[model samples]
Target chain A: MKILVCIKQVPDLESRFKIAASGTWYAAEDLAWRLNEYDEYAVEEAVRLREASGEGELVVLSLGPERAGEAIRKALAMGADRGVHLLDPLSHDKDPRQIAGAIAEYARGEKFDVIFTGLQSQDRGSAQVGLLLAGLLALPAVTTIVAFSHEAGLVTVRRELEGGARAVVKVRLPALFTCQLGLNTPRYPTLPNIMKAKKKEVRTIAVTDLPQVAALVRTEKLAFPDKRGAGVVLEGATSEVADRLIAILKEKTTVLK
Target chain B: MKVLLVGEYRDGKILPSTYETVAFARKLGAAAALFLVADPSDLPRFAGKLYLAAAQQCGEYNPEGHLALLLQAVQAEEPDFIVFLHSAYGWDLAPRLALALDLPQISEVVALAEGAFVVPACNGKLRRTLRPLGQRAVLTLQSGAFNADGEPAGTPQVAPLTWAGSAVVELVGYEAASRGAVDLSRAEIIVSAGRGIGKPENLALIEGLATVLGGEVGASRPVVDAGWAPHERQVGSTGQTVAPKLYIACGISGAVQHLAGMKKSGFVVAINTDGDAPIGEVADVLVVADLKQFVPLLTGKLGGV
Candidate 1:
């Protein structure tokens, strides 16, 4: 009952973002890096499954520059048995397919019984890698999973759909599920675990070891999203704000007007 | 240019997002065809030809079977561009299809201009104009970013196709969230609450306002994730895309994902304590006040009026 979880390091969403001089990506020098929110659930789920079964080697895999090792170590502190870091210096701008292909290259040899990933990376927001990796691996793939249960080499997951519809699916072993929020609350790593994680070795694999794939999408330029318009701000006390809002709704907009 | 628009349908109804994607494909002024993966019943006369891949497995919306079916169709009917709605299904399928076909793929496109695409990155704080460097490109159009009124006036051709693939997964059942029969997408007026509402009990003020305004209650993702509201009442990229006539957002600081769902509303009113909240930029009426204090006042005043 071996399980693999794919995690990525991302900048904290609350941080102020600055466009790089290249006008293509955000400047990373001053940003605070943390584990991606969705992948936190993925790692938590993997750790819980391992704890429940009381058997199985839980491997946390991440692909990025050296900074991503921090995220891998966090997963280790969260109770993963080992970590595999696919190290690549020029990995930031690669598209999802290329990233998934590199992962498949490494994953094909390991043959874990099940794989888990975040529904989408916070940075790309393409929601592509998990499904693409599943496709490349030719395994059963489910996305936006909120609830999961496992027994007897069979896994059942509840997936979140558009319009808030939910579907329960069952898949055989050697499957892949991309987790969404509300699946489980991630636990903070204790000081002892953090010390233990620091001692744990993370095996590094160079991206050059894998087949090179070119990016499909080319970014020409990046700019701030155009502001819609100047909104009339109602200030002062609570009553005044409420009064102004209601007055505008009744006088300017169609609501109540 | 030849465009292959992959259409999605569910529960015996064609998704309106497909029409919006078609509307975008029409902007390319290409010879477009919609490849539908559903029962070919009541097929709307789209602006272009329609091809149906009514495979049994595809009926339930599994990505594996749909990918294989669409791959088969793409090989047979090669097009310069492949378009899909950037909905739940599209986000899952486009990358794999592009990889298998060795084509370029872009997601969540808001605009197409002069062979370049406008897409959001860095959590929608920045927009990037991208170009496909491949011979053919697969794209997913952002929902509500395009016009839905571009279906041609004349009848289009319908061609039946077959898919030969196996589903690696099986759908056991579906459980619709209990949302008190409130479909936020169809609601004309929506009063949505955010985390600023503080607690689950504080939702009564929001509901009270909606009740008096004769509208439905929607919520931000945090509120829904916290169990203050059902997922069905959530409005966001992962929840529901809505274009209500009037949207009153209470305490929502405006995460880009949440704004993606309601930015198209006819009118927007935002209430939050922070004047610098991103919601202030998009809202037509910005009330910079604490939602806990402001909601009750607004509800009470509206009630008396």
Candidate 2:
């Protein structure tokens, strides 16, 4: 019944982003960091599974800079037994293969029954790490799972596919799943739980100490997506705006006709 | 460069995205090959080498089996680049194949700039150009990024592949998403809500606007995930791709996933407080006003008109 949930710290989506000085990613300064929204569901699902079993260790893992420890602490506050932080100051520069390889290196000997990860991180949005990690570990994996159930060493998950389709899949123990949104409502950390999470053991492993995996892909440059076009912005009184919109809709589109 | 384009077969037909991948390869101007897990009799007119594997032997949507087949095809063809559509099938299998081959993999490539792949990050607010370190790599092209004009010309030398791998994951079956009674795809006009709508109760205003416009009510992913709207009414990459005649996006900031669903609409109007929202980029008309104040006025005026 042992479960491992991999989490990541991502900048809040609402944050105003600027191209970093390195020209390969967003600027680190003035960005508010938080647990990746999708990973929260992964952690919540893992905690619930551990609680349902009534006696299993739940571990949360994160690979990021020093600030990522905050995300691990948040997961611990939500009921994970412990945290493992793969500390890398330049974690943002690593590609999905290297990130997955580092996690695989750490989890190779853990022998957890099931591993959980978010469908993708908000920053990188590659959606490759979980499956890559599964491949590296030679474990069966499912992605974008919105529903999950485990019993008698068999795990069933319903994956959200394109166009809102769902694929029901099953795998034996030692499988991996990438949790999607709506899987579960993540519980907020209570004050007492937060205090207790402060005491939870978080084992930090320097990513340098792990077997180095060469990055297969390198970020050449980062830039704002080109604007499709300059839109005609309507301002002033709401009534005036509505009037102009209706007029344009009638003139420009067949729908109003 | 030699490129191998993998086709996705589902429900006894090759998906349209497969041809789009061909369009991508054509755009790359590389010598290309096609691979599919389908009978040769029904194969599309591909202009290059075609690798075929019987679907029965491969199993429906079997990752391990597909990986084995693809690996064999890659070995036989010795392609420099392997391409797949950034689809459910590709998203699941490409990384596995990449890791197995010990090559780099890039997903959801929207464009190619100076030979580097351009992909969206930070929810499409930023774009990153990625360069593969090695000559051999795997890539998944974003849906709708490339246009397939027609069936490719010329005869393809068909090569059959075999897979002898044992399956570790079982496909139980598929459950169609409970769509209830709503189907956003068929709607002529849609008024979609987003997080900027402020609260669940604000959906009534969105519905009102939809009703006045003689259209269906649609919503972005966050609105549906927040239980402000039904799943069937969702319009996005993971939800439903809609190309309605008129799409009035209310309070939707337009994440890439959301834009993918409705970017094909005949005309778009986005009403949000944030003028800089990504929705403005694609919108024909951007109304920078609080939806709470603007939607009611717009709906009332449109209904009266």
Please give, for residues B233-272, the per-residue lDDT of candidate 2 as tens digits.
8898888889999999998888878998999998999998
TM-score per candidate for chain A alone: 0.91, 0.94
Q: Write the per-residue lDDT of candidate 2 for residues A124-238, one digit (tens) a residue.
A: 8888999999988888998889999999888889888887888888888889999888888889999999999999999999999999999899999999988777568997437
| Chain B only, TM-score of each candidate | 0.82, 0.94
TM-score of every prediction relative to native: 0.88, 0.96
- Give the CA lDDT, 0 to 100, for residue B261 in model 2: 93
Q: Give the top-scoring candidate (DockQ).
A: 2
Please give, for residues A1-257, the per-residue lDDT of candidate 1 as tens digits: 88999999999765677788888888888899999989999999999998988887999999999999999999999999999999987777787878998999999988888899998888777788898888788787888899999999989999887766778888898899999888987889999999999988789999998899778777788777776666788875477677777777777667683
Give the per-residue lDDT digits (tens) of candidate 1, residues B134-247.
668989988778877745455558777766656677877788765666678898899999988998999998999899899999999989887899877889876888999899
Please give the lDDT score at residue B112 for candidate 1. 75
Error of 2 at A212 (Å): 1.9
